[model samples]
Target: MTIPDTGLRTEPGSFRDPTNQVFHLGGDVLRGLDEQAARDYRTLAGTEFFRTLLAAGKVCGTEPVDPLPGVPWTTVLRHERIPFVSHPYEWSFGMLRDAALLHLEILRAALDHGFTLKDGSAYNVQWRGVEPVFIDVGSFEPVREGEPWAGYRQFCQTLLYPLLLQAHLGVDFQPWLRARVDGIEADQLRPLFRGVRRLLPGVPTHVHLHAAMQRRHATASTAAVRDQLRAAGYSRELALATVRGLTRLVERLDHPATESHWADYQRTCGYSAEDRAAKERFVEAALAAGPRPRLALDLGANDGRYARLAARLADQVVAVEQDPGVVDRLYRRLRADREGRVLPLVMDLADPSPGGGWRGVERASFTDRADADVVLALAVVHHLAIGRNVPLPEVVDCLVGLTRPGGRIVAEFVHPDDPMARRLSANKPVGLFPDYRTEVFERLLGARCRIVRRLDLPSGTRTLYLGIVGD
Candidate 1:
């Protein structure tokens, strides 16, 4: 299908399906439905089932629109754009779990309305704050009797197994999920379970049995599997039963968070009340005095202390933390408060997320997506420089790249004598970072950004600087 060039551009990651194509027009998200898709959409749109899902916040609501300038779309739907688009790899454990449950919930509800989901890709779900909302409206189609759910194995690979691995083995799933966008396969994850864990109730059926079946059918053609399912008399009732069983298994899964070094940073940082208060004052003054930013990025947002502060001054805040446990806790707190301004993500600043999927543009890199009006880098310079062995000039350049031109950045510089800095540099020689002093940092930063303000905290160990990016 040829999409019109009314300054409307399709999202790179959204080209997998031909039934519906998503485009951005003047910052609004619009979905163009093909002939068959438009017909099916008309059927679903007229039903109360779709309205109920929208009302319950189970799916994103859409408004109908006529065909655009030159495109000949049968039907177009203007969907409410999410404030921020986060991927499964960036989500915390609880976030992914809730999303899995939401997927199954929608599946169960759809069956009641004579509709079924075509696939179970985790990308189909996005977070509106902490609430999981289905974004793929085109996945819905009329149900057929004697046909098994086509998304069954996909759900297992993308959502079920990832959750089970974390709940059972205590392994962090973020890295693996990021490495393999398709999620872990059954064959690879099967051997990870051993001893008593292999005997668990759902393990035998969902994990072990599913893995064995996949191995047995590895060489089988799609036609062969269809014939086998047809001969076995697959029905709608059986599909629903399978979904219900998987829901139960996913609901029972849980991962107790282990404490990270920075999780309790405020209490264990050895900062006096006066020092902490002074830091807060500097941050507040910086936000109040600077130009209001629509989007804010908080690097190394431990427990989201500063991110929450920035949320009050910006329209949206993206909190990036390296530790999954800290991000999980932050996500839970955001959900409890129903705070939609802040979005917490699991990311390591030193490595950062790279742009990789097809042609290296399907999924944008961290810097590519971050065009923030303001960025908060609190107590993180030493870790990036001394701990990660990143050059100080490179760190400054990265911060500059994160903020948009003429945007503001509130960053803290830790002295070499500071406890945290000392710990990070304990094993290294003193002369290793010969140019790590504040003077050199200021000079380097001043080359790319104009320093608006600088404040020395009462602790005499750290200094905060507010700078605006140069044109």
Candidate 2:
């Protein structure tokens, strides 16, 4: 027998679901299923129930793929790939809230038709254009009474608790979710107790109640307690009502924050007329680098200024930012006009998503998305290398790895004595980066790509470097 198509570049978070495995096939997505799950998939694909949801535009439509006869019982039915893979951590408070609401809505719809979803992870729901689509069909199992929804606590932890963290404490838990995929635990909430109890109602309910329940269950019999709650008339309908109430808590807890930089991005922007002209000229020259990419990854896309420029030239642009407020601003702008092909997301560059699954073969990582023809690293090196404590050579290695053989990289270097660099000097980056001179950077970059162009910014301190790999 020939080997299976077991090649993967990166891993995604939601690969642990027991029913079916999601994988990438020649850049397309395919799901492998067991006998039982395959039967459910076949049953669901032909049903009026699924068709109703698809027609209602509540979920993505599933096209049936018949496997070859006598292929292994564990074979996959290839399917059409989704255009985007979104993480709950990348979502806004409203986006996450809406996802929670949509999850409950989909589950309730499923329950109405005498079916039950085995899972309720927020990671399973992805946005299609402007709507959330439940893509995990294998998660649906037959519904029965007196059995608690297995994903209830997950719904609370992943969606409910983190959202409450944002509202009650004004802390966007998106960053926290990246490291801990299942989301924060209760003990983690102990520190957030100060103002949350006094100011927010929903925060107290979801956070305190959920945490308390988790701590209590550390030694107590959970099955007995669950059975008790079930016998106490907490049926699926009643449980769903409680879930709806918990979702409403987000409305009461809704308080968007305006943090440093994003709140006054336009005001604090130090771009002079000449500086703007020089930067735009650099970008214009960078955009002209060959056939143009269908996908572009704009690292450090602050408020989407450069991403908007790149979006003009590409069909899809993934704008990555660590600051939620900036990402929020970028997302709001993108969502408001609906004119640009910009997908702004909040993600830390240093510790990005990784490949995950059985032996880690199914899902891809954040770095896999970095394989773009064009990568714009405008004014971003200081943050990743200096601010985040990554060494310069390693950073260069990452930038080079992202590009195609002839792909271009546009990066900015702020000198040690510059005013902006002076402000960041106290952060120990300058001490660690004593050897990172402009000439040294050019030499290292030249080793990987041809130094196509370099110029002094009108601001008089920073310089932009445009290079193409292997000449």
Choose the strongest candidate by TM-score: 1
- Residues 135-164, model 2: lDDT tens digits: 776687767687777787778778877877
lDDT value, candidate 1, whole model = 0.86
> What are the lDDT figures for the candidates, one per model?
0.86, 0.71
lDDT digits (tens) for residues 1-471 of candidate 1: 224558888887877889898888888899989999999999988889889999988899888987887765789899988867777888888999999999999999888888999889888898776788999998999997777787888888878888888888888887887787777888788788778888865788888888888888889987788778878998778888998998988889988678877789878877888888988888878777766778899999988888898888888899999998999999999999888889899999998888867777777788888998888988888889999989989999999999999898888999888998888888997789887888888888888899999998898989899999988
lDDT of 2: 0.71
Which stretch of 10 consecutive residues in model 2 shows the poorest summed lDDT?
1-10
Off by over 4 Å in 2: 1-15, 47-49, 52-61, 68-86, 90-92, 127-132, 187-199, 203-230, 262-269, 350-365, 384-391, 426-434
Candidate 1 runs further than 4 Å off: 1-4, 219-224
